[model samples]
Target: MATIQEIKIDLEEKSMRTLLSAGTNKDCKIVAEGDSWFSYPVVKDIVDHLRQMGYAIKRHSKPGDTLENMVYGTDFGIATQVQRANNYGPISLKETLRSVKNLKPKFVLFSAGGNDVVGSELAQYLNHKRSGLPLFRENFFRDSVNGHIKSAITAFLEQVWQVDSGIHVIMHGYDYAIPSGLQYELAGIRFAGPWVLPAFARKAITTRTEQNRIIRQLVDIFNELLISLSNTYPNFHHIDLRGRFPNEAQWHNEIHLRKEGFEQVAKLFHQKMVEILNYNPVA
Candidate 1:
């Protein structure tokens, strides 16, 4: 658990990109990388708060580094003797340990959801779409959708923990927001709505009927799997961010969080940290 002593924050929101002010936290470290809805603002906000507490912050993209020997010496299995470099060029565990130990983050907060809906197929879509393959839909196969998400998430968590098990890993799940509004045509091909629907409405559809059905099913399945994962993983905990703050609590983008909505999420997250990580804003 983290104390007012010092810390670091990693912002992982892949839905929207943002650049958070790295103000100051000589004792704490703040790591924020924004891309998709799963990145930035969300992560930076946390880092900003911790930094304000007199902690030094390390801002960087995912798969950051920490050198061996210098780390907290937790032997948390975070170090994969084999140097594995994530997208942002090459890095070593020794450097990662040094960075993390420097920031002294009590726990690691991983915020991601929504993007998986579109992300599940992003790679294939990119490749397929490039050649005009046309065989690309954000959510293609419902059956294996989560199996896809499961594999990706498991791999990601493995790397995160590998960096440092002593660092509590908080895996945030979807339902951080709810059906503030339907993502799009609820009826899939039919476009569920009174009247024969409006023109331009077709554009609001979720690809095709099969695609929509598969997407919805997969989202539900994925959340279920997430719940199970949380329960199974000792350090993993699911914050009950389900339901709505109010009818208007939803973002116009079907799944994104509105400003007020995000506020609610921030509060819940903060409270969770206070209770689980012994965290508090510096007075």
Candidate 2:
């Protein structure tokens, strides 16, 4: 399994508590790493506030993995490094493992898969095109990434479990996106309307159920596979943020959380964190 080094994991058997590694620079402690889907402003708000509250955050971004160590809080001092993930390595599951291995945090929240999903989608599209499937890429959808995604997730979790049984893992699931034909207005134009729609605006409508079907099915499959693996492990959880949004349109482009979906996500995750940590939600 791949690893992300240089993080510290502070274990208290408590849920939703403020991060314990405030001023420590232990590798792989209190780690949070993900892909571009996390780049959305709505998705970023939670991490931002966590950092403001003196919780250190590490982000994986493009143009390579750049670690930013910032200091906050006078009494409860903590410095965090936001690691940019992309420019250096291929941003595959390996880099994630490397980052986690470096931090070695007790608790980790993995915000990943949008890239993998998009990549799989594109691959399906190209393959379908070459095969002359007659279905437009716009009309087709990639339900999920291949077993590589599954393998990556499983390998990492198993590795963590073996490395430390006390380490808690919250395998964050996919978020809602913009829905097709939802009549959303973006960039001074309503997608439900024609003509005035900007070239950059997405006009494809895959319908709410279809899009949800694609994502939910994949989430269910992957989460189930992950959970099945977790049955033999400790402190592993599958965090679902589905339908937690006010609208189904949040999943428009695949995995980016909608502008209106963060609060619900944070609440659900925060509550789940509180629940599991408080009671060992996992068997």
Candidate 3:
């Protein structure tokens, strides 16, 4: 068996043809694309844990990517372009679909929409505290959820099925996060995030209790949208992770999870994969 490091391929660094020609096990091959949760720099992320569990993953993932950008094959803005240029970013979904058609992996793992809803985009959905209105601007929020997030994902799924109808897609709704103003740091350098707190601060929503409440509402709605997609599409599997990481220790920052937390989340994906593939590991 190959080591976990050997089993995982960065699609940005190497092509899918290279991965396939390297004698990767076809039965366990997986294509993964998404944001920081799957591609966090210098840390073992969900895709890394999955590789440890014996799956060969060809990953096209970059931190801070949005679903719309992935679907439309474009970077979100100047900031995203700069980040991609620096990081050697993931390819667009259209390019990924071409890979899918050739590789024909049994499963595809997608992690997106978090960047679309949170980060700098979050303030658009928030109402001013002085307005005495609902915490979220309902119409705008719903439009983003349905028109933007769902539409992009739906397009991706349809494109995947066009390549191979047998390919299943496993997606996750991110766990409820604490907006305690925590940012991920490494070696005393701030790498990414403080994703949620800035929006709360901008809206003058300060109390931890209120922050938690608002985040919970956002997570719930997002998960509900994913659940609806699962119900509608037989091949789409939605992993509801809300409240799964209840403790602050499970989280590394405002959005990403700790190593152990990610391992547990990967187990959920593994279980679903087992059921879908009727997989039995070699003893």
lDDT of 3 by residue, 113-176 (tens): 8988766688888888888998777777877788778888898899899999989999999988
Ranking by lDDT: 3, 2, 1
Tens-digit lDDT track for model 2 on 1-283?
3211111122112212432445453322355655433333323334433333343445443311111101010122233465433333233444445655655665666655544443223234322223444322423332333345555565556655666666677756654333332332445564322211111123232345444444454444545555564575567777765556545454433334453454455455555655755642222
Model 2 residue runs over 4 Å out of place are 1-29, 41-43, 52-54, 61-104, 118-146, 161-163, 179-212, 246-254, 279-283
User: In lDDT terms, which candidate is top?
Assistant: 3
- Give TM per candidate: 0.50, 0.54, 0.86
Cα lDDT tens digits for candidate 1, 1-283? 7422222232223111221224432212333322222222322243444333333334443321111111222233333577553342223334544555555555555554444443322233222323444433434444344555566556545665676675555554544323223442322542222211111122233334534343344455556767888877876666655545434335523344554555565556556656664655332
User: Where does candidate 2 have its weakest 10-residue lDDT segment?
Assistant: 64-73
Clashes of 1: 42
TM-score of the candidate numbered 3?
A: 0.86
Compared with the true structure, all predictions reach lDDT values of 0.41, 0.43, 0.80
lDDT of 1 at 261: 59
Model 3 misplaced stretches (Cα beyond 4 Å): 1-25, 76-91, 281-283
Q: Which stretches of candidate 1 lie over 4 Å from their true place?
A: 1-102, 118-146, 176-216, 245-249, 278-283
Highest TM-score, which number? 3
